[model samples]
Structure formats: C-alpha cells, structure tokens
Target: MFKVKVYVTLRESVLDPQGNAVKGSLNSLSYTEVQDVRIGKYMELILEKSDREVEETVKEMCEKLLVNTVIEDYRYEIEEVVAQ
Candidate 1:
C-alpha cells in the first residue's frame, strides 16, 4: 500500500485574499508579529500497489483536478505502508 500527501498553495504571483483576510484578523487580535499569511490545502490518499508509478499518478491527478495550474502550485509526498 502507499500513502500520498498532497499540498496545494497559491502561486507566488497570485494574490491570496483569504490569507490576507486571516492576517488582518490576526493583526486586529494584536498578533502583530505576523508578517504575512498564506493559506493552502492538504490532502491524503491511499492506494494499493499498482503497475503505474505512484508519483506519475499523483502528478496527473493534481494537474487534472486537484490543482488549478494557472494560479496554484502543488507538491506531493509518497510513503510506503507495511500492512500489519
């Protein structure tokens, strides 16, 4: 078995309104030390062993559905699971 962890975030050139809102709220709460805030998405998926390469499958999934390539960037980690 394999476990995949995917992280998606706004592209560096993209404006993150949600993150900015959070930062504003934090500052209003007197958390002035925060210089910026960037919001992101994390997901986990499990798959049985397959003939396909895990990384390639994950990349295709991300590019096709999980991420908006024009505005977002993504990365993934794969871990092998040993069934007990």
Candidate 2:
C-alpha cells in the first residue's frame, strides 16, 4: 500500500487575506513578534498496490483537481505502508 501527502499553498505573488486575518488576531492576542503567516492545506490519500506509477498519477490528480496552478502551488510525498 502507498500513502500520499499533498500540500497546497497560495502563490507568493497572490495575497492571502485569510492568513492576514489570522495574523492580525494573533497580534491582538499579544503575539506582536509574528512577522507573517501563510496558510496552506494538507491532504492524505491512500492508494492500493497497483502497476501504475505513483508519481505520474499523483501529478495528474494535483494538476487537474487538487490545486489551482494559476494562483497556488502544490507538492506531495509518497510513502509505502507496511501491512500487518
């Protein structure tokens, strides 16, 4: 079995209003040293053993649905699961 982890984040050039809001709230709570905050997403997918290449399949999934390539960037890692 294989497990895939996906991370999606806004592109550096894009503004992240949600992150800004959280940062503002943190500062109001006395976290004044917080310089900046960037929010992103994390996802886990479990894949059954197959002849297909994991890298290619994950790439297709990310580009087609999991990420907005125009305004966001994504990266992933795959790990083998040992069944008991």
Candidate 3:
C-alpha cells in the first residue's frame, strides 16, 4: 500500500484572509513575536498498489480536485506502508 501526504497552501501572490485573521488574533493575545501566519490544508490518501505511477496520479488529483491551481500550490509525499 502507499500513503500519500498532500499539503495545500495559498500561492504567495494570493492574499490569505484566514491566516491574517489568525495572526491578528494572536497578536491581540500579546503574541507579538509572530511576523506572519499562513493557513494550509493537509490531507492523507491511502492508495492501493496499481499500474499507474504514484507521482503522476497524485499530481493529476491535485490539479483536478485536491487543490485550486490558480490560487493554491500543493506538494505531496508518498510512503510505502504495510497493510495491517
């Protein structure tokens, strides 16, 4: 089996309102040391061994549904796992 770890984040050129909100809250709570905050999405997908290339499949999934290509960027790690 393979385990895929996907991380999605807003593009640097895009504004992250949610992250800004969190940062603002933190600052108000006297956490002034923080310079910036960026929120992202983490996802795990378990995929059975298949004929398709893992990297290609993951990239297709990300570009098609897992992430917004225009505004978000994503990367993934694939690990082999023993099924219990």
Candidate 4:
C-alpha cells in the first residue's frame, strides 16, 4: 500500500483574499510578526500500488486535472506503507 500527501496552493502572483483576511485578523490580535499568510488545500490519498511509474502517473494526474497550473501550484509525496 502507498499513502500520498497532496498540497495545493495559489501561485505567488495571485492575490489570496482568504489569506489576507486571516492576516488582518492576526494583526488585529497583536500578532504583528505574521506576514503574507496564505491558505492552501491538503489532501491524502491511498493507493494499492507501490511503483515508481504509478507514482509519477499520479503526480501527472494531479498537475493535469486536480490542479490549475495557471493560478495554483501542487505537490505530492508518496510513501510505502509497511504492514505490521
């Protein structure tokens, strides 16, 4: 078995209103050290296969269908799960 962790975030060039809102709240709370706070999505997937080719294919699927390259950036890591 394999476990995958996916992270999707907006590109740096794009403005994130949600993130800005969080930053504003933080600042209002006297958290002045917080700057450029950005929010992203996290996903976990489990696959039955543990092959290098399959991992690459899943990554490509994320880039092509799961993520919008123009505005969002995505990265995924796959790890083999050992049974006890």
Best by TM-score: 3
Which 10-residue span in candidate 3 carries the lowest summed lDDT?
47-56
State each model's CA lDDT, in order.
Answer: 0.92, 0.92, 0.92, 0.86
Report the Cα lDDT for residue 77, model 2: 93
Candidate that beats the other on TM-score, 1 or 4, i.e. the better one: 1
Model 2 error, position 69 (Å) = 0.4
Candidate 1: give the clashing pairs. Answer: none
Q: Model 4, range 1-84, lDDT digits (tens) per residue?
A: 788888999999999999999999999999999987999999888777658576787777787888888999988888888755
TM-score comparison, 2 vs 4, better candidate: 2
Q: What is the lDDT of residue 56 in candidate 1?
A: 84
Give the Cα-based TM-score of candidate 2 against the true structure. Answer: 0.92
How many clashes in each candidate? 0, 0, 0, 0
Instruction: For candidate 2, write residues 1-84 as lDDT tens digits.
Output: 889999999999999999999999999999999989999999999877563788888999999999999999999999998766
User: Which window of 10 residues has the lowest lDDT sum in candidate 1?
Assistant: 47-56
Q: 5, model 3: CA deviation in Å?
A: 0.4
Model 1 gets an lDDT of: 0.92
Candidate 4 TM-score over all chains jointly: 0.87
